[model samples]
Target: GAGVSQSPSNKVTEKGKDVELRCDPISGHTALYWYRQSLGQGLEFLIYFQGNSAPDKSGLPSDRFSAERTGGSVSTLTIQRTQQEDSAVYLCASSFEGLNYEQYFGPGTRLTVT
Candidate 1:
């Protein structure tokens, strides 16, 4: 089977610009996750989606960041009013039935806000 995939491997946007990053998870996966990796922070959890519904979004840095999964297959992470602090490698991962330890990860989208 195919692995997870993300779009716009690298993105450069000016401050205050909004961007939408996409992710396509492995087929039949019931769990999806969005994480961010930055300097000093190895990897920070952003959101988790279980069957098209996100049960927890507490890891999001601020209100400017949002995420949604559809059809339990695709997900999008949107950053509104982007800032330099948002520059990082956004990683998407998927697992079957909420199993975090066996998740397959995408290459990630590197976003740089200047």
Candidate 2:
């Protein structure tokens, strides 16, 4: 089965541009999550979708960061009007339902803003 995947392992952009990062999670997984990790920073939860409902969005840095999941499998995180401050390694993970389930992470998309 596919573990998880993210595209453009790296991305460089100028300020005020828009970029979209993609994530493909494993099949049969009903829980998915998006997170961002800045240099030397812990993983920050961006959004979480269990099935099709978003129950959390408290960690999104700003209005520029948004994400959506389709068919409960693939997800995309879009950053609009990029700023240098938005630079970070975006990580996506998926897990099984129930407690003590471990999340599998993708390689991550590193976005650099100039």
What are the clash counts of all predictions, listed in order? Answer: 0, 0
For model 1, residues 14-112, the per-residue Cα lDDT tens digits are: 999999999999998899999999977888999999899998889999999999988888999999999999999999999988454598999999999
Q: 63-99 in candidate 2: lDDT tens per residue? A: 8888888888888899999999899999998888655
Show model 2 residue runs off by greater than 4 Å: none
Instruction: Find the candidate with the highest lDDT and give its number.
Output: 1
List runs of model 1 lying over 4 Å from the truth.
Answer: none
| Candidate 1 accuracy as TM-score | 0.95
- Score residue 48 of candidate 1 by CA lDDT: 92
